[model samples]
Target: MKKIVSFTIMAVLIMGAAVMNGDYVSAASVDGLNDKINELEKKKDKIDEKQGKLSDKQKNTEEKMAKNKDKQAKVNNEINSIDQKLTKTRNKIQAKESEITETNQEIESLTGQIKSMKKKIENLKKEIKVLKERIEQREKLLKDRLRAIQSNGGSMRYIEVILGSQSFGDFISRSTAVNTIMDQDEDIMQTHMAEKREVQNKKSEVVNKKKQIEQKKKEVEQKKASLQNQKQDLESLTSKLNNQMSEKEQLMGELKEEHQKMEKYKMSVAEKQQALSDQAAVIAEAKEKASSEKERLKQLAEKREREAKQQKENSSSTSGSGSAAPSSSGGASTASSGGSGIFIWPASGSVSSGYGGRDLGYHYGIDLAPGYGAPVHAAASGVVTRSAVSSSYGNVIYIYHPQYDKSTVYAHLSSRSVSLGQSVSTGQTIGAVGNTGNSYGAHLHFEVHEGPWNYHSGINPFPYLP
Candidate 1:
């Protein structure tokens, strides 16, 4: 847009310079110069109004950028918090793993103990069975001896045997013999009862030991199961934390992109403000020149009127003709009537992509393929408002035409020859087309805007291009 601003101010300057140099100045022409000055002032007011709007936009952009920064910071903080939680959860999981390991070992040990107790219990059962069989046989023998005595005559038979001894010696021997037999029977019965009680006690002790081991083993297994459950819970928590962290990081990345876009927009606004300031300078100079010319013309006309009156008094019949008005050769170049159209094709190639939506997405401008390093030209005579490298457009130039109140862009160039604020004519080489920025191949991206170029403000160039 600086291009259009400079062009209009230059026209005003030219007019003022012409009036200052003319030898025969006229009052009417000087008044016309004043009128031009007023017009320039009006333009200045409009520029001020635009600048004010731009200022508000810049402020809004900055505010948005600040908001984005805050959002990014918050996301970062959330990610950090998730990281901390993940760390703690992982630590807990590790601890649970250790507990589970210990619990498994304890269960194994308890199981071994239970197996040993079971074997002991089986051995006790076998020993008790043998003892019971031996005791039963001994008891049967005792019962048989008792039945024989009962059939014979019970106590009477034993008494008769004792009395029927042949002599005193024989009686003693028979009595001793009877006593020996009875003592042997009593010893057998006592031994059987003791053996049965010992077997029963051993069996009971083994059974009690087996029960204790089994109970201990069961408790250990339950502990292991609980540990396993706790570990599972920790693992689940860790997974959730990881997912949250990923989401937060993604949000942070998006916020960073938004911040960068806002920065670019803010820069564009600043460039426009600078252009307006330059135009204001031009208008001030033009106004000064117009006022000076007006004063000079008024004095010169007064001097001429005096001379004419003196001449009329000297020659009563001779009436002088007023000075002829200055010729209308306004010493300024007129606006260019671009040969056949308002704009010239910026590159020598067919359009690779047209303006509007396409398969990949929206195409804001036409893409031209004119080969690598091919020269790219301006579409019209205008001032260069932007000549810089952009992440998306690469080596690009922006020019504004005051004649049509429009702007044009040339982008994706191998190199740029013009700088910001430079004047360019239609068909002038400002750069060379090549693969630059977000381009697929060596090509030029051209755009035409009905007014000053802003983001996504491009219109179809086909209507205006020759």
Candidate 2:
């Protein structure tokens, strides 16, 4: 009986020690699982914080984009107004030219009329000279007749001749002959005077006509000069208007380019936000998985504790309780550490402008000039979200990093080497720098965003660039 009691005591001690060992193993497994759950929760918290920052950035960017669009619309209206004014100015110039041509033609016609009048005046002067000569001849003839009459003893000689007549018939003949000669001389003098007066009147009329023609010609010439001066003024004004139109067109082009850029940026931002939402879903799923695993671990720990307690109770009784070994059958999965938000330089160059307000309003990217056709590289490993020509950015590319919940943009490219949905690694060549879109010189415009690519989502790129 003593030997049997000793064996029983040894068996009881062994069984108790085995039960305690099982309890210790169960506690250790539960502690390890708890640590894994805490780590997963920490990761999820970090993701939440990042998501919150991105959401705020999205809101601000959207507001800024709306304001920019409004300003762009106003600029477009102004450009259209300038175009209308330019068209009207051009029409006025054309009308002025036509008026000048017509005025020149009238002046030419008046010049011909003045030449004809001058020729007519010369012919009239010739006719007046002939009339003057005829008048002088008639006057000399009258003088000669008077001289002859005097030589013949004038009126007394005529009376004596009539008194000395031998017969009455002879006396009558002498009286009749003297009267006829005097009458003839008087008639000749009157005819000469009349012809002279008529010629003088005709000459005077022609002279008046010439004077009128000359006055008309002078007026026409003056008109022509005025027209010429007007034409010159109009041409000058037209030239000025053309210059103004050219300047306005340039301004409008710049404004349009800027507007397009803003629009593209807004679109990119919106897309990035969608990507973020998708990433958030993934993170939520991961958190849910972690929660499920934690619950499983807790249940397993409780079950092991219950079994250990039951084993202890059975071991204290008179009967021996067979205890099964604790089995640990759980696994933990960890997420990969994503991008650090640091980037390689997309192009080899010096920074020309930084993110912030500028002459053109809020600028969301950095400008780098390295001459034309400089190779542009990816800042980080990502999937190409966009790769195509943009009216404002030229050949541009957008890269999205799901792991980091961030996006990058490269603008003003001469050529694009990547395509949408293409995967790219860090420092991979994606395009070439250029002076396209709203850019004034050959350069690269790059941007980074913590969330989606939005107008206000951009941070200073220098901090993230090498």
Candidate 3:
């Protein structure tokens, strides 16, 4: 009997040790899960910070692009003005060229007139010379005739001829002959004077015509010179305008290049943000699982402790009764907290905006405005697919329900209390509603999707909600 009691005591000690060992293992597992969750939280924080910086950078880039657009507009206006000036300047230059051509033609015409007048002057001079020579010859011939008559017995010979006439008929005939000779000499003198006066007048007229034509040719040349100078000035101005336009165009091209670079950089930032979000989501999912496991293990450890205590108490009480040891009980059964194909309100608020056409544009979701920082709940029990910050969605969450083959989205959150891949029950608090990500006020933007969540692919959620 003493051996049996000692053996029974030894057996109780061993069973108690086994139960304590199981409890210790579960505790260690819970601690390790806690450590993992902390690590994941730190990673999520880092990703959030990165996302914030990216959003700021994107805003800055957009501001720069807006300024660039303004500058481009100004440059375009300047270019347009320059183009107009260039057009006018070119037109003026064309007109000047035409004037220059006309001036040249006038000069040519004047030159021809001047040349013709000069030729006429030369001809008149030649005629004058010939007329002077003929006058001198005629005067000398008349003087020679007078000398010949004088040498042959002058006036007395004429008187002798008239006295030598034999009858009255002969005297009358001699007198008539002498008168006719006097009349002929006077007529020759008058003709010589008239011819000399006519030649002088023609020479003077030709000289005056030549002078007029030369003056006109000089004026036309001066006009042509003025036109050429004007054309040169216009050409210079046109060149300057063209250069200015080229500079403006070059500036515009540079701005456009810069804009493209900025856009590419912005795209890169967005991509990085997305990658980081994905990474964070993955970490969150792990963390959520770890957390859930930690809780489960903690509960299991407590249960084991209670069982061990009860067994030890019973062993102490029945140590001498010779009773058999009780077998250990099974673990606590886990209940499914999955979706039931029933939707609920995601938030407590009045609907500020409805789904579909809105004043701003097409709205695929509904906006609910509660007080600021109101708790945002899940619409149904589902697994969290995404929980991340976004440029447009801000602090957002997406959940997918397998029962209904549908998804739900909650956006514009101030803070999130859930993690990716975490199972959530209907009306579970997942976040807080506040102004974030394209929101004008403190509100929750909620949506329901028939399938997986996609941008602007939500159906009206009102019908699903009671």
Candidate 4:
């Protein structure tokens, strides 16, 4: 792309130079130079415009680059934050682990207490059974004693036993025996009843204690289940958080790559910009030199015009064409009619550059700014060797002159009027002025390539022209 730009500008420069060096020119010839001069002005304007556009584009590019960098930085920050979260989560996991350990210990402690309660419940059940048996035995003995009292006739049985005494002394002994027996029987019955009540109370106590232990067991089991669920929930949440962190890390990686690519792109753009600047310098230098050459040619034209005007006055009696070189262009005197190794102007245009490399890049041709659709003639008769659009030169035309061991390359032409392998004569129009592919503007970019590397044919066309 840069090469194309270089060629286009060179073509414009050559076109500008073409108008600056016409000998035997006059006001009449100004029409021909007018197009080229206008073209040069247009080129100057275009350069300014393009510079502005380029500046804007560069600014945008830089802004995009800065924004990308900032985005990458933000991504980095997010990654860091995620890392911190991961760290905190890990700590929480450790803490959770400790909590789990304590919960396990509690479960174990609860289990042991439950085991002890179970043993107590079992022992109480056995003690209650034993107490009930002992109470039943005491009640059975009291019932038998009551039965024996009833046999003696309940309340009257005691009196009848005392009255049935065999003698007075015998009766007294019988009565005493009956009273003592009844009292003893009553005492035994009361004691037995009391013992039975105590046994029932003891059984109730044991049953209540067993129920309390069972309730405690149920509570601990519920607590253990809850802790297990909590641990599972915590693990699941940790996994989700980890996944989020991983996603953030992946995002950070992508941002980093984009940032790196932008930096590399920035470097490349900067290098290309530098090259463009250098090329501009070279073009400026060429313009300065061409300007100097134009001044010299102009001075020479003025001197020749004065002499031609003198001669015209001397031949006042004959028909006058004014000057052979058309003094109308800048009022220059006519150029010499006959000269050795003379070549006619290939196209009517101002030369924008000389036959050497110019700035922006190695511009290998002189530029000629001709009128739109102007005829471009062959410098000398030769075979049309190459005619095509090139990657950098756009529409290009190449001619090979016989016996010169050299070739001329014309680039940035609008169209070619000749065919490859066709022979052309000197002064024959073989092409037209145009701005084609890779060309920034209209003009003819012309170059003379010498036989070999040591020849100026590719670098300079001055020595080859008359």
**Cα RMSD for predicted model 4:** 16.6
lDDT of 1 by residue, 242-318 (tens): 77777887778778888887887787777667655655654565466566766665676576557656766666654
Q: Residues 118-188, candidate 2, lDDT per residue (tens digit)?
A: 78777877887888888888889878978988999887887787788888898889888878876887789
Alpha-carbon RMSD, candidate 2: 13.3
Every model's TM-score: 0.68, 0.52, 0.55, 0.42
Instruction: Encode model 4's per-residue lDDT on 171-229: one tens digit a residue.
Output: 98998888788787777678767766766776787678667767776776777687677
On lDDT, the stronger of 3 and 4 is 3
lDDT of 2: 0.69
TM-score of 3: 0.55
- Cα lDDT over the full model 3: 0.74
Candidate 3 has its poorest 10 consecutive residues by lDDT at 1-10
- Summed backbone clashes in each candidate are 1, 1, 0, 33
Among the numbered candidates, top TM-score falls to 1
Decide which is better by lDDT, 1 or 2.
1
| Cα lDDT, model 4, residue 412 | 73
lDDT minimum window of 10 residues, candidate 1? 1-10
At residue 44, what lDDT does model 3 achieve?
78
Q: How many clashes would you count in candidate 4?
A: 33
Per-candidate alpha-carbon RMSD to the true structure: 6.6, 13.3, 15.6, 16.6
* Stretches of candidate 2 exceeding 4 Å from the true structure: 1-113, 155-180, 216-258, 297-466
